[model samples]
Target: MKSTVEHLSPTRVRINVEVPFDELKPDFDRAYKKIAQQVRIPGFRPGKAPARILEARIGRGPVLDEVVNNAIPAKYQEAVVSSEDVKPISQPDIEVTEIADGERLAFTAEVDVRPEIELPELEGLAVEVDETEVTEEQVTEQLDQLRARFGTLSGVERAAQTGDFVQIDLSAAVDGKEIEEATTTGFSYEVGQGGLIDGIDEALEGMSADEEKTFTSKLVAGEYAERDAEITVKVTAVKERHLPDADDEFAQLASEFDTLEELQENLRERLGQSKRMEQATQARDRLLDKLVEGAEVPLPESVVQGEVDNRLHDAVHAFDHDEERFAEFLAAQDKTREQFDTESREEAEKAVRYRLVLDALADREEISVNDQELTERILYQAQQYGMAPEQFVQQIQQAGQIPAIYQDVRRSKALINAVRSVSVTLPGGEAVDLSDLLGPEDDAEADEAPDTVEGEVTGESAESTESAESGADTADSTEGTAADAKA
Candidate 1:
């Protein structure tokens, strides 16, 4: 067997492979066995017929076809392994060139490959991030949140206000027909959360106990989604949260702190730490933007198209692949299919470029994802999807998505490495020390920093806490922050 590679472009290659007849004996045997099991012979038992006898019965062309079909994939893999530099990122476009009887088989495969990237110097890159400033007001807000957690609700005799909690019965009718899924009784909602139906807050604000109001709002979900519905909300009870006074007793009740002053100080320190973490997140995102913007990465068209197709498939899947419903959804968003296509293409290209940049950086830095890191990422993802780790692992393995997860973890680490190497400064040009947020290794060489820190400080650590606490979308957060820096 022999193989040769042709560089079609910076990010693609064509591999031509030839396998002599002697090398395909195993493939031929397997093909014969498979064919024999499907066909019956007059004298031989099932799957017990000799290869020559089977070939005589099925003809040489069918046997050869079976052998070629079974042999190509394995041979292609061998060809890839033999060529040390040919790393394909997409499925190959294979064409069998020749299959001479009793001679040799030849084929060519064209595929997208990782491009050679000329990376910029990591240490010399400089980026600016917001300074970590935990204001007194922020500390107060945190304390207020703590107090709210321990607050009690008492019935009120007045109209509902913005901060009031209310118990109400809701019913909706679209085109004079009641929507079953949109009706609920004895529902508790905060006055200004705005999550239930649109215009519910306005209707509730001025209503007192036992008062009913009807308002028209668009149903955002269920069968009547995007349709205007006449909603009748009847206020059963009005209540307001009565927070405890910020005193030593209240502090003792709310936390382990013996004094309110100590609780305030602790809250301030925690807020400072959170702000520093935010600074680190901003630095990570900005550094990634700088690296991607400064580098010249040739995107693979096939990979980008694959990503776009996946996104489109997911989008249409939510509407059960009904094209008309999808079109209606776009219309509701005030967007056309053309606009969605353009935006999806742009997003796909950006995502591909990001992955490419990080992969190149990972190679340059010799970054590797170990078993522990991979497991940790898998567990985290399982938690995100509300599945057990074992179940999640099984699902991903069956779906062949483990490699994608590994790649995401690798890219995340690569971006973190770039963040640590880059110089991060405040608006006033003062260099900010992110050692506390980025872990001690990030500042190990600094004269004033400690020798070591426990734990890794990557974007995952910074974003994971925020995502878990606020249920923030990690992709949207990163994209928004990166776009802000770019702008």
Candidate 2:
């Protein structure tokens, strides 16, 4: 067998492979064996039929066809490997130019390759991170929220008021035609929560028990629906929130604290932790922006195409396999598949570029993940799926997602380390501790970020965070790419 490769782009290649008849003999033999067991000859049993007899009975064409089918994929892959390029991001477009049952077989595969990157300056990048400090007002606000969580609902004899809970069976109609039906015999709502229709709270504002009234409101526009429908709703019940007595008993019942003051302090600590996390996230993003801005690597087109395919696949799945629905979806987005691909092409390229940067940084730093960290990540993931830890690990391994998960963990650590290596300045010109900016310590104990949605960016700094949120705007921004969902 002989092979040759031609560069089509910085990230694409075309490979031509030629195989002589001698090399095709193994596949030919296997195909003949498979065919001999499936057919019978007049003088011989099915499994006992000779290749020559079978050839005369069924023609050599079918056998040759089978041989080509079984042989091409393996040989093509071997040729590709021999070229020493990274694995193809997608299946290659293959074409056979010559094929003979006992003669030569020739084919060509066109595919994308991982791009070689030249990473930009990674150290001493300029960035600013927000400093997180717990305040008395923040503490008090959190305590109030905790109290609200413990508040009880009680039926009200008088007209309902704001901050009250209401339970009602709601129905709607339009132009004398019943348009919507939503019945919850015990449906509860906080008057100003806007959990229901926009005018619902106003409609219930002055209503007493057993008092019924119908009101009209506009339906909120969505991705597909037009915005002209008016809805009618009838109220059935209203109730007020009754605050629990903020005493020692309440504190003990609500938490592990023995007194109200202790619970308030604990609440303050928790809120501080949350605020710290938000601040950390903002700083991390800012640092990433600086890193990406400084990066000088050329993105691999294969990786970018892979990303585009992923985005496209997600778009396709959202339509639920209904062609009309898919078309309507694209229409609503003002995009055709080709157009969307064209638009996301740059984003896809950036995504792949950032990923390559992160991977390379991980390798350069010799960053390693511990078993405990892996176990923790896996366990947290299991909890999200509501499965046992061991069970989730087994399922992940069985599903072949373990390597992906490991890579995710490694990349996360690498990004953190990358950020850690940088020094950040505050708006007031004070140097911020990179450790404080990376994350809070309790992140290990708290629930991990939801595996489904990407980790949301929280908090904002006076500078850099804005651009970071906009995505990597600078050469130094090294924000990792968002993960792809399972296929």
Say which candidate scores most in TM-score. Answer: 1
Model 1 per-residue lDDT tens digits across residues 1-487: 9999999999889999999999999988888888889999999889999988987887899889998998898898888778877767777889999999889999999978778888788878888988778788898899999998999999989999998999999999989999999889999988998878889898898899999999998887776667678999999999999999999999999989999999999998887776776777678777778777888999878777766776688788777787887888889899999999999888777766766677678778876767776687677667667899999889867755556555555556666666778888999999988865555332322211111121122222322211101111111112111100111
Q: If scored against the real structure, what TM-score would every candidate get?
A: 0.89, 0.74
lDDT of 2 at 340: 71
Mark the regions of model 1 whose C-alpha exceeds 4 Å error after superposition. Answer: 440-487
Model 2, span 333-376: residue lDDT tens: 67786787677776665655555555566666776666666576
TM-score of 1: 0.89
